[model samples]
Target: MDSMKNKIKLLAVTHHDKKNINPIRPEASQIIGLHRSGEVDVLVLCNPGSILIPYFEKEGIEVLTDPLEKKLSISTVLNIRKLIKNRDVDVLHLFNNIACSNGATAAIGTRCKVIAYRGQTGNVSRWDPSCYLVMLHPRLNKIICVAKAVENDLRKYLWGDKSRATTVYKGHDQSWYQNESADLSDLPIHDDSFKISLVANLRPRKGLHVLMDALALMPEGINIDVLLVGADSNNEKIKEMIQRSTIPKRVHAMGYREDAPEVAAASDVIILPTTKREGLCRAVLEANSYGVPAIVSDTGGNAELVENGISGIVVEPGNPKELADAIVQLYKDRAQCKEFGVNAKRRAVTKFNVEQGVDATIKIYKELTK
Candidate 1:
């Protein structure tokens, strides 16, 4: 235990700007809090031109910009050398692919420990494969997989050092669920009708189209509104898909929102109809914490978070009719929804709270340093 007093300095590396990025805010806050509380000394490394560099600096955390971006250099080796010399960072904690590549390089020459976080089940495309990443950094002391499915994928695809891989279920802000009562009118979809929400990036993997198909196939007229929340319209594929869908006026496309808990509280059901490949989604936990049961795809870690016919209903991935039937079934049975919602809250409190996640991370750090 005395070794824990070494007071190791940590460098959190990510692709997005820590200060202004909404999705990464929870992770940034938790890591910063861990540092502020004397568990670790922390620094942040991100793209040079990020908007939130000053924000991280204001929080008393040192910020490092990718020198390559600033100098307009293409040589990664020189850039990494510059980073090591400038930051004098002791350990590298990577979040994104770019961060892992650069930070891993810096760690090699220096006496810095490398810990990479693989938050998703797989890469967005072949260009960003997580398994390939594990192959790139053999000395990565730990690889934090958000789901068991992700861990399995890493084992099969990358065949990474199994001894180093650890599954830490994504955590959520518990205090957001504790109070419970809040205004629903300001929410994206707040009609007196039953509201269902699917909080995910407007991407194919999210399977929003399948949800829309399911909603359209419902036999009886159900008074319900579906709220879809996310950003990243770079592809505009989702926008095109939504425009072509023949669903009624009940389905709402609400863009990126920072107040996710409030949005979850306003909705009656949380739906995650992923096509395939997902980490333990934080949105489902957020919704479940607010006593909103989820209708999630059974793939990846969705089943791990949601107990079938217990906390939430699990439908086959990409099955629109099955998803629709499950939604309609839950809608018809208010008693079941309430029961599942209560159980969901209990599960979230027990397994997915931020404190528990931070504690688990701290324990891992202690074990490593020991």
Candidate 2:
């Protein structure tokens, strides 16, 4: 308490997804960054079994083992209320919808400031009563959006001062993606084939069907192979889509692999053909971090991540022909593909690095605390 007296007190509560820490790490790491910065006394509330628990302990961060109850759990709210009062918390930073709702409720009648983290776009409406419990709540001091797309979407429904919502991209260190690419020989992809990887669940919004459309449209003997990672890749519908496509054998759907980064690293290029409401695709970021070029649809913040014609290609969403054409451009020019890879990696390190995000988070804290 003596050591922390001069610093801002930050309490961040979020569930650490055990399946993949990549998406959640940026949020977690910034808390560590704030602690390291010596400007904030950080506390974390997460699952007890989180892989990050050891790291939190190592850093001597005060840890609380509760995800803070999802959506108005009474005990969770009371715990948060008690922590705000007892810890003299300055900033209550909540990640995810459940935390935002519960954390805001706890902040009522308290002097503590609250910040809500928005990771995606849509699924919110001013007309929706549930949204009022979360995003449209009047008590929030700020809304930390993970991308410009998310900020814009959220601003559409904010009943309070719209300026409270700000876009600050969740960033990553390139070092986290430096793993040796896994062996691809186990799969049917040929040695000479141009590998294109995608690391999202096979779903409509993810646009697996649209990506399949482009693959089917590729001319015969193009030597392109697709690597599909994440869940539901082996489901009957996905299998049927592949079976019916022209490049039936070329698409390999590997469901939820621990070695996903390694698999993506082995690829010649990455693609996210997401159709709508994407905040930012972490798969594209992972590939870019690995010095792999990407071809993403022009939906949401895809364009922000991939600098079109420099780092990678951006095509109109749901347009299989444009996606196919973009793929062909990269396919025909291996040199250009490699160049894009270099630029992609450079973009990640220069603009979207973790330090910048941490600084942005600190700026928000300073403003709220002042």
List the RMSD of every prediction in angstroms: 4.3, 1.6
Clashes of 2: 0
> How far is 242's C-alpha from truth in model 1 (Å)?
5.1
- Each candidate's TM vs. the true structure? 0.81, 0.96
TM-score of 1: 0.81
Q: What TM-score would you give candidate 2 relative to the actual structure?
A: 0.96
lDDT of each: 0.72, 0.85
What's the lDDT for residue 190 in model 1?
35
Error of model 1, residue 168, in angstroms: 1.7
Off by over 4 Å in 2: 1-3, 67-69, 231-234
Cα lDDT tens digits for candidate 1, 182-292: 355544443467888887666688898888788768766667877777733444765655554455466666676677666777778899999887888877887888898
Q: What is the lDDT of residue 261 in candidate 2?
A: 72
Give the worst 10-residue stretch by lDDT in candidate 1.
68-77
Please give the lDDT score at residue 304 for candidate 1.
92
